[model samples]
Target chain A: MSGRSERVRGKLSYAEAIREALDIAMDRDERVVLMGEDIGVYGGAFQVTGDLFGKYGPERVIDTPISELGGAGVAIGAAMTGLRPVFEFQFSDFAALAMEQIVNQAAKLRYMLGGAVSVPVVMRFPAGSGTGAAAQHSQSIEAWLGHVPGLKVVQPSTPEDAKGLLLSAIEDPDPVMIFEHKLLYKTKGHVPRGHYETPIGEAALRRIGHSLTIVATSIMARKSLSAAEELARQGIHADVIDLRSIRPIDRETVLASVRKTGRLMCVYEGVKTLGIGAEISAMVAESDAFDFLEAPIVRLGGAECPIPYNPELEKSVVPQEPDILEAARNLVQGRI
Target chain B: MPVEVIMPKVDMDMASGKILAWHVSAGDEVSKGDPLFDIETDKAAMEVESPGDGILRFPVDEGAVVQIGRPVGWIYADGEVASDPPGGIPSSKDEFRQSVPGEATADGSRNNISSGPDNISGKFRASPLARSLARADGFEIATIVGTGPRGRIEAKDVRNYQARRESEADTSDALAVSESASGTGTPIILLHGFASDAKSWTRLESNLGQRPLVRMELPGHGRSQILKAVGFPDLAATVRQTFDGLNLDKAHLIGHSLGGALLLDLANARPDLVASLTLIAPAGLGPEINGELLAGILRATRSESLGPWLKKLVADESLVTESYVQAAMRDRMEQSTRAAQEAMADALFPDGVQAFDLRAALARVEVPTRILWGKQDRMIQWNHALRAPGRVAIHLLDGIGHMPQIEAPEEVARIIEANL
Candidate 1:
């Protein structure tokens, strides 16, 4: 095969890619619709909706009042009727307000109806802290929804993944949660043009290494990558697997890396206890990877407290590059 | 001719066998039916006789656990020279080839070499500065090919591999171009399918008769550039350039599975470069494909790992030799091979369904085309043969499966010669 280096094309901001996905799904299928607070007229809290209000008009891109629960209920109801509705949450923490509609109705309805009805609803939560939106505005609540059986939880780390995952989330048979890290909005990366699904339940191997495997999600996945770079500086090579889909979590890829590295490090901005890391840690501990472990599995998650209003404290409360580097070093060295 | 003495399938369900002992050394002479090696299967320990009279060649040392159908050694008969098997498998220098798997020395483990800031010994042959920089960045120092004195992985090689800086070399030559086809006989371009290389066309090589062919290893397959992130069009363009690189304006194109679709696109993209087209159970004509086979070959580290998948390639499971399986596995271990293969597979057959429907393209092509398919093909349906244009020829062999070249090489080679 001719080995010409792959040419990078079509750079897009994370926000632009999400909006592009919305535009693509709507243009391709008449049944696809967008509904959120100010998403139609004001262009959303984060403006991820873009100018869809003017393009697709009011009926297709409906603007709703500030009622996450009510709007979520309507979206779930619309999904039951086979109209693909992508409901937007102003922030992920707001998902707590719509737990009844999202978890109980949208998620369980497919099985609850014995496969007679499907709720193909996609919910986008502008998640994670970086804009100093404090606890309410900047929470990554994927874990809360990930714990539920029927709902698919995901956190797209780049612009490319954001667009592809959003489109796939729209076509899902059940509710798929898209937790877009707030800070990643303006970050630019090459996004493939056209409709393509970055298949859910598959972890993206960001980089390869042999010393350890760092399982990271959302913003933490990027931070862990930088941290992995630092680890490589001292000759510590690590395999960084971006847990794009938290639910149906790709256990095969995780186990495979752990089998090679003999060390595991879970990196996420969620709370340390009962977060995604705990599940991943338990997955390895429960699997054959436990016997091959050179060091105890390490989870560099958020502290056991709500994210603070103070920016410095907020940064300290969650895992960062330095924290990931330190933890990876310790794990690789068997210092744990 | 050197004959590979494989780990015989002692039982109907035998998975693997361990070597009890080898009576001969690397260059020792042996004869047919002689006591060659002692093997221990789950059933019992038995002596394996020589398959041919030749000098014994051990691919691995004693005490190695080999898959049920693995070629542990070879026998080069008198009056015949021993060469690498017909398949284009690169010679392996795997540490395990000299010892048993899981045999770790006190110095360090062969399977898992420690890297990062924690362990960069001088014996590793990496520059201290490059090692330090790589550790600080967490980039793979081993993945970077060294260009310094004695092939030391200098700071620049690591930088280049990372694409941190661009230079004269294309991404592997822009990143360029695999094994030289015998001689400049006739530059016939042969493209293999996913998880396959130029070597898959081995059986046809002898019978092709004086036609110089460039048996191209598909990216991620053999000694070609591993474009881990290339798309179908880019791949087609690369093949088109292969014609130019060989200074051939046009040549006969033969592709299998994914390669079949690729050649079609090349003919569509640049018909002048492709004189004639021969597709073997090609993809893009239908959506059906074997998901398990793709997954099996991609994940297999050894021949055993490819057992079930290799068997699905043909109607007769017995044709799936240990040497063939090892050859497939060998090409798989090519550099950036895993990433390249995975990317191509995901693009071409996402969710086990062939992504593109080339039927429309087939109807457009004016080139002389022949679609060869095995009626019993379990990978891609032979019914896809019906999609061929009226002008295009079709041959559906009754007994073969996905691989028509390996099963009916004589017929296939004759078809190529006729097309030429």
Candidate 2:
């Protein structure tokens, strides 16, 4: 962990970084095991598992049948006993299939059993819309699980956070859900080698500004950062906060930025009505930060519909860089 | 930190008081217990003593109604700079710049501070943060111009307005002129007195027909910049500069009170600029003057207290209307303007006595001269007209006060035309 923080380990794609984290975790802990459909020999759907199955063999990197419910149940049972199972869901939309096991069993067993049992299961869901995955394949369901008290939900926007947060999720004694945006798989960033855990329940301030504060999650964070850059060129600056963990949301980070900027705009891929933006807006209104607001709180979230198969419609459903730019400009310029 | 001067609760159940007058001008040195200002409650008027010994600086102009315990001014130490009282409520000092919800402009005209679509609801649309800032800073929401949708006032608007006021306070010697002229030939320039502006000649101007009329707004009045001068001559020079800018070879000059003094000086110094001279209850003529009435005029911030003082300008109270009171209130909108006028007042009427003797200037001017004084004028003694040169025609009208041009505009106009 110390070496990773000190050394420059070159650039790596987000998918490669997550694979490197799985490789390092399995090597470091004997109890660590990987479970998912076609993950072992088929290199998984996105090729994130890649050649890890050849190196770790069938026992450590086990591939399950195409049953999300059964796969998630087995992963939870293994975590409850001794093995630290890392379950992979082909698409986050499939989490709806295993909600009974994930939300009721894996999330509440530790609390209901009076802390006598622990479910140290790490579930990785390829989330978000962008690649024409249609309604069934692409969805951002982090807020759903984030509402569950016993589970830890996180979304990593960069390669470094993707690797570090994965390592941390596996180490957590409670069940942790990782919502990794599929669009970010090919995006490359400097991912330091070796072990590093990005602590859960913390946010990343991507940009510091005085004009307005922007709270974004997952892929929206990346888009907001780019939007902030463009806004800077137009003489409007913004504070972009990447809420990495939604379950134990970093209230202080969001509140402090709102207080300084006197304006707030939340960008998310979840449905616009009751998504992460609603929670953030409520938190600000309920806190003293509400009084510091110079303008009304704005939300730039997904449209009120499922992800479409048409690429143009899919892009329109969620907040893009241009959407972020316009909203931020309106917010800072007092036009909102 | 400077010692704050707050409105004291003189009587039980008194929530607020109207400032009657300030005994000490801004930057004046005083010791503790010295008379600072006079405030009148519903029951009685009383003098408020100084709280500390230092240079005095009043934030609120005279004639303003202040709530009890609210700061009226500050007493800074000898070398201390006059910053506003920390966390204290700002009132008249920021009146011109800070938009208060539902506040009428200086001209008694409302400017629709909130031009938002919800204006019909009579509610100001400001973000929670902006509302918080305005509340903390003691700003009125309705007065702030919103830049957001539906004319919603945003946080930046409040901050920017505050910044503008702070910068305006630091500026000096910048003139704000309002000029209007009709008819042809040489312009007949009208100069108003203290606490008066170009608008004061409205009645007189209408009576002076078929000639160009140029109304020169006095410094610290109307839109004119706050004058920064030490002596009467310096004040005259500033007006002279404005006069020279007109590029007129010669013009008929009509002056009232302080304006009369300035015109007399101008006529003596530059005879070529004076075609004829008319002085109306002019100052710089005698020692005896109504000090209380002048102080009342300077101190009044509210129309209630100001109306009575202004009624003293004419023998009949009917001449002072609600609109006229409000128009006078506009001249006191800015605290700096009040301070500038107060400084000039102190120099001219140190103890309610005229300081300058314009008899020599009046005698030296070769232009035709005439003096109009109301027999019932309470501000200045009409008997001062006796000191004018034998060549200068003097008219003392009955049932008139200091403002002969306003009370007897037709008669004053006829006298001016006859002199011309």
Candidate 3:
């Protein structure tokens, strides 16, 4: 949509846009603060919290203990006490250790207290695979927290959206889990200045087409756009919908595209079975979109096996741009 | 002219920077390397010095996060005047931005998803998907309007649109012609071909006694409301709407000429509606159609001129009765009716050639379909009956022309009743 292509205004990397959102939110609202291990002096694992720690100072920008539970517990406690704490997980894989605090405390405190308390906690997880972080480091665990009703799951594909959605997430009364793809940190695009919200549950139509529709999430959304362009050259147009928000999936937008093209392919970096694609497929199947389908719906997610340490093997586990293109061609050709 | 100041990428990993405080305010004269502002990166807070000697100006708020390579402000040289500011950070406005303290954050109010792609909030148009779903479910999308942007039919709109169909279609709409309230059998849906209407079935009506009949005016023909545009899909959809509105799950279809093609389209679109197919001189058999005969029938205001095209309907001149010529001439005299016929002819039979192909639809038909044609039919080529798929029962009569029901009603009736 009229996103990065509006004009040649300067470009900012995904990491930079996120930092800008944090700076704007914290500066405007005194209650908003930052917390995580190695965030203050060492920046962040991916260095997303740049200069934010230094500007807000030690109290507002906290560097916690190495223990995942201890760090996550402090952030959740801060959120309960009328504070908007944005906690960063050095690696999304580390979220497993802090699940108790995230799911049980930060997510439930507002409801458990019967509306008396509000946990306006925003947790940022440097998720996804690309840099061969191996099994322990690279994992797309958004579905884990997304399954819990109390948490809102969001993945911003563009630099502009990353800034806007993160701002909205911070303002949300409930806990918002922001899954930032580690490989996407260096990607750049035009970002709007100041503070503006992209809304939490809305989906963005990245590219329009008539042949087939692709519902993509996170880095896969970016990859799909490229795949769509390549497909366009071959006279095969592919529609792509960037599923910015996962839990509150925009069914109308997805179904609308599916109806137009009569074919749908879900591209995700998470595990194929019972992942976001499964949810989307089931949603369309149950909805009226099922009747419009000319071909069986396809989902190209990661392999069932754990991410390998080898570079080539790591690339093979999750779908790449080529993989998305192939799946789109297969779906349109009625081969699958 | 003043020079623009940009946020510098201080280190390899340094992504974003914030202005903690400005050492020099706007209009403050400064030399190169002079301290301009105190900036902080993720690693450290440092004072970034001015690069040129001029009046220092700020384009961004003190606390706004400025990305690397983005213009943060401008530096004006001595004796230079500026009128407008640079284009905003992806924003096309002269006003820099609201300050952090003044910035109003979103309350996280989730807007209605169906407000369309760009937050366009009123009126609902059925999205392609909602229409496909509606078609697949055998629901008319045009009748299923939702409260989306301009009544845009989102998926929920189609589902919710189904709830209103049963009661809404029951209202007094002049389009339907179901006389005997109770359907005694699979009601035979009679669709008259081009340049014709329900009066064309007068002879067949008496021949098939006690049989159920659902007479439908294919929109804008008789009492039905005129369709604004008569495309192939639109015409098919109109008949499907009337067919669905009747609440008839299955019906035996007896279509003549283009009406036969419409039934084929309906079967292809929604095969569940037709129990048996009976096509009399259908259009899709071949691409050829007699333009002169069609144009002459619609243009002729006198029974004398209309008698010629009427003669071609049967093998013998005796079938062209004075009453038939008068009835056909009477239809052409209505200004509105003639205009609708003209539009339908141009759309359905463009440039005197049959514009549509129902051959693909023939393969989709699962019902026991039969084709009846007179060997001497002149209006639509009788050879069109030759292209009918092998499974379709073909009966080529000897003496009859195009109007098989009128020239040979007993044989046509027997063929239709046999399929039942």
Candidate 4:
């Protein structure tokens, strides 16, 4: 006897993949919950949670008070108990308010408890700029949470990762912070139909090369991958490490590639100073991998300034694909 | 010359302050410290002061939101002739061009703040002050993890959270060790040799296969930079501290060489903490030790030279990887590590002879004790296995060296698992 053919292929937006994950999780486990502002009847600000309220009803798909702190606290409380809550922030910019609940409480509770209690919570933030939401609304803060301890921070650059990581995050015993790039919500990709769990804290080698290791996360990962493809045309082979999970970051994978290429350029959309690049640079410095580095670790991040409202100024603020290619060229040539 | 009057980061977390009302309009002369405008922040509303004595050339309207550290208006200092306004509205043009709300200003340049998500309404709602301050200083509010009431992105939350996050990231990145441990068995305590920590047992620990084990630095290794003259008493104190920190009442004790000796010391000092003892070619059993090997271990300068010395402890030379040797060398070079090693070598193996002959202590140890010895052990002679008390069990492996725990982990684990 053969198993029933159940594989269904369909084109779904990034937003839809996330919604489906929540839907599947809620369906399988009644303990799963959804909490965020305007995530109820309004179907969420971006409509990523469309009709979830109607399907799961009000208790599971809760519309929390207009307080990020309060909502995060409630989610954490529920997670500490038995339920798995997927808390959402209308925008990633709003994640700033819930830092204490996230960084101090949720991220640390497990380690502090000596792994006695498992915190299975998933906090979602809509990140990135490109829809011209201006300064306050259009920002990518994945790098911030990725720096915290106890918390597993993940950025799904593709629909498949979004679905897979979301499932993994919801099922995880520790707290997980998921950053969904705003521009990527509408972008479509192939998402397998099944309950799949993507390994957290592992870097995905998107495009393999031997010239330079481009360590990128979140939206910048896609940008770096594109830049690597473009650089490949000019004979500059750039290996791209898509850091799906930032905290407990896959240093082994990054170091392995850096050791082979002998060069590294960490590219992220966050500001340059203490961005992900700094962490990667310090990792290279502390490891035996440092001796293998032929070129100085290069960091290409957003300009050290607030994002601009003007289209031209906004474009200038962040490192685009071309900027990454230029940096990669310079790094491989020993220019910095 | 126009003296630009920029808004300041009034509150600790304020990124942008909205201009509730511009007190002085175009052509209005204002003195230093004079109320120029009423700015409102997420925290509270406050008035901005004029920087100098001059005509108040305001470019932005009364209700405009001005960013922190952005020139909102200009004060023409006495005797300094004002240049022609770039945008035409004389009094307002200087302020407008110089502090055109969102125009890049010099109050605090190069502030890169990460942005947040796209607005579903297609319109982002932020105070005017936040917008202008963000633009001028280049602050991305998105990168800041806010602690505001309701997740409202505030300026103070951004700065504080950023600093905290950066510090945390720096610490973790600097200390890069694989954190996750795999295993599903009772907790086992693995102690390291002299000048080494739990990391030395990383390979053996991985091979143990699903047993909750915690490998920690002995007194002066890894994070435990303890300083005390290395002796059985000092080693016992370090082991006690580790057990208290981990809240472990009883654990299966596994130690290699110096660590093995330390385990015996712990058992002799506080027999209650040890569930069972697995000593891999321990030091306290025999009076006979290789003086040349002990001296070589203490004086080896380069990792290359030390590699062969370390290989002598293990039956299998394959266990001595370049990275492993480098890690050992690095640990050996630490001030605390060096001190601990020298003190331990002197205390345990003074004059290249076992300092504490624990044959009597072995008789008193009620806990089931097992000792494994390598026949070809170069560090400590294998004949020590025969010196164990009548009650203690001893296993002698042919061709195995001093570090059987690392070289012959499978056999050692099988012996440990049987006891567990």
Best by DockQ: 2
Please tell me which model should have the higher DockQ, number 3 or number 4: 3
lDDT of 4 by residue, A145-262 (tens): 8777688888889999999999999999889888888888998999988689888988899999887899998888899988988786555688899988888789899989977787
Question: Which parts of model 1 are misplaced by more than 4 Å?
Answer: A1-10, B1-420
| Stretches > 4 Å off in candidate 2 | A1-9, B1-122, B138-147, B156-420
Interface RMSD of each: 18.2, 18.5, 20.5, 19.3
Candidate 4, after superposition: displacement of residue A161 in Å?
Answer: 0.4
lDDT of 1 by residue, B1-420 (tens): 357676776643345678888888878888899898898877789998988888875446677776544457777767566564322221222211211112213331211221211111222345554676677778766655444332345554466455523422433322233434465543566788887777778798777777667677666566565553466766777776665566676677888988898888877877776678889889889888888778877777556667778898899889997776655665564324676677778877788888778888898888889999999898888998897878989988989899989998998888777877
True contacts kept of each: 0.00, 0.59, 0.10, 0.00
lDDT for B68 in candidate 1 is 46
Q: Across residues B354-410, which tens digit of lDDT does each residue of candidate 2 receive?
A: 888888888888898888999999999999999998998899999999998899889
Candidate 3 RMSD to the real structure: 29.5
Tell me the tens digit of each residue's lDDT in model 3 across B1-420.
456676665643344678788888877888899988888888889888887889866456777675454457788778776554433232222212321111111332211121111111221244555767777888565455333332234555565345334424654322546454444777888888877777778788777767688777665565454555677778888777767777877888888888888887777677777788889999876789888888888776567778887787789879788876766665664544667778888888888888888888897788888999989888887888778778988999998888898888887888777778
Ranking by TM-score: 2, 3, 1, 4
TM-score for chain B of each model, two decimals: 0.61, 0.62, 0.58, 0.54
Best candidate (score: lDDT)? 2
Question: What TM-scores do the predictions have?
Answer: 0.45, 0.53, 0.47, 0.45
The top-ranked prediction according to TM-score is: 2
- C-alpha RMSD for every candidate: 25.1, 22.5, 29.5, 24.3
